[model samples]
Target: MRRVAMMRATFPDALVTGHEPLIPAMTNDPKDRHVLAAAVRADAAVIVTTNLKDFPSAALAPYDIDAVSPDDFLLNQLELNRIATLTCVVDMAHARNRPPVRPVELLDRFSVIAPQFAEEAKAQILNQSEPSPWLIHQRREID
Candidate 1:
């Protein structure tokens, strides 16, 4: 929720998308289809979820949506950390935390591992929703 709220505050004009019907099988209230429908509508390139098997590749192939894990998503964020400008701190954190993650260690570990997976994961995170208004506003600001 922090990330979602951040996007709202940071990129208010960003286009964020979500599955409308929300597949019935995947939910208690179950709709006609799952997130796939929404992703298809939005033409998403990646869909981040732990349930990779739940969303079969063949099913998503038509829409060109690639299912990715949270690890992959975090890695993508790390890779794209340049935009957020946390390179030095993130690198230091990663270097400090090597393996056998404890809670505190995990945070530092993610900082380092995230960048490696950025190329593949960045698209999924952005595709999770349309650009937020803030993001759109930032674009205008940049222009």
Candidate 2:
């Protein structure tokens, strides 16, 4: 619960509560109803998840929500805003502390989950004319 508390503290307005009454109404996996309830209460348009079976289309269609895979969602986000999406990835890499992870390294790790999106993201970062964000960051540290 410490991790949840930390998340709530970090993003106060992102929290949604009092959705338990809706849990019994959700048709997805019984174990995942709380998530569905929260999505319903939050009026989410989509629920990106690896466990597709847990959030069936029939179950979500009534609420006007779609269950999408994380890979597809990331790809969609990239397509919607290429530079901003890639920059967010670069920012995540930049925030790494104890064992710093560079953007290339982070993309490599992302491959295990979202292979196609990671490949395209890596290409965009490398193909861009500007020095890669990681290179610029490393150069700053060295100086």
Candidate 3:
């Protein structure tokens, strides 16, 4: 609840909708039906979720929506705008001021949540310039 409030405050333009109309079950999990229903209501082209298995492509084809893993989604964003993505990553690291965060720490955390994306980001970061201490740590940990 606090996270949702923070997100709403941070991204005012982000759409925040109420309960969507119930629709026929699209996946094996009855609870996931609400997700599809919300996507249908919003006419979203892609649904970014960790639970990709719950949203089969065949089920989403009719609605022109595709369920994408977070890793794939972040990779696509990185591909579209490498500099912007890096900037976002840096900003995210800076936001963790309690203990202070390093770029590599952020990447390590991302690696746990999105391994494929973390690898791709690390490669990109390495290609751009001389590796920093944090980057070195990231490489050592990932290897």
Candidate 4:
């Protein structure tokens, strides 16, 4: 797409490397150990991962970090803020008009990844319990 033609490779502001030695022995997967170690280095509370089995709770509990699938993460976020989450999804759907995706169709695709989130979001939307767009709180001013 023309929008992405000149885009540079993106990276997080913080970079963690050479964390192999910091990895816990309980993190059995040699390939993914560095990911946990990097999380520890970055002091992240959660690791959004599709490979949860590789980062079991037993290994992550000591580091006070959690490994969750993208779906589970989205579900947890939806639970925390249904209005904002749905609003975001709706906005994204609207923005994707070139391909012409409906909000429900987008939600349907989300259902494949996060069934619980999709179900709960649908229920909330259909019930009209979510506040209007204007009701969402303003972003907090950064210090």
Measured on C-alpha atoms, candidate 3 has an lDDT of: 0.76
Please provide, for model 2 over 1-143, each residue's C-alpha lDDT reduced to its tens digit, 9 standing for 90 to 100.
Answer: 98899889989987889899999999989999899899999998988888999998888888998988878999999999876887788788888876998877888889987989988887777655786566455444322
**Candidate with best TM-score:** 2
> lDDT values of the candidates?
0.52, 0.83, 0.76, 0.71
Which candidate number would show the highest lDDT if scored against the true structure? 2
lDDT of 1 by residue, 1-143 (tens): 98699779978854545655444323211232456666666677888776667677767766667888866765665567734533333343445444532323334344454544543333433343666454454332221
Query: What value does the lDDT take at residue 97 in candidate 1?
Result: 44
Task: For candidate 1, give the lDDT.
Answer: 0.52
Q: How much is the lDDT of residue 34 in candidate 3?
A: 82
lDDT of 3 by residue, 10-103 (tens): 9986653653544564553577878887787777899998898888888888889999988999999989987678667766877888898776
The regions of model 4 sitting more than 4 angstroms off are: 1-26, 129-143
lDDT (Cα, 0-100) at 140 in candidate 1: 28
TM-scores, in order shown?
0.43, 0.85, 0.80, 0.69
- In candidate 1, stretches whose alpha carbon ends up further than 4 angstroms from where it belongs are 1-4, 13-34, 74-143
Model 1, position 91, has a per-residue lDDT of 40
Comparison by lDDT, 1 against 2, better one: 2
- Quote the lDDT for 99 in model 2: 95
TM-score of 1: 0.43
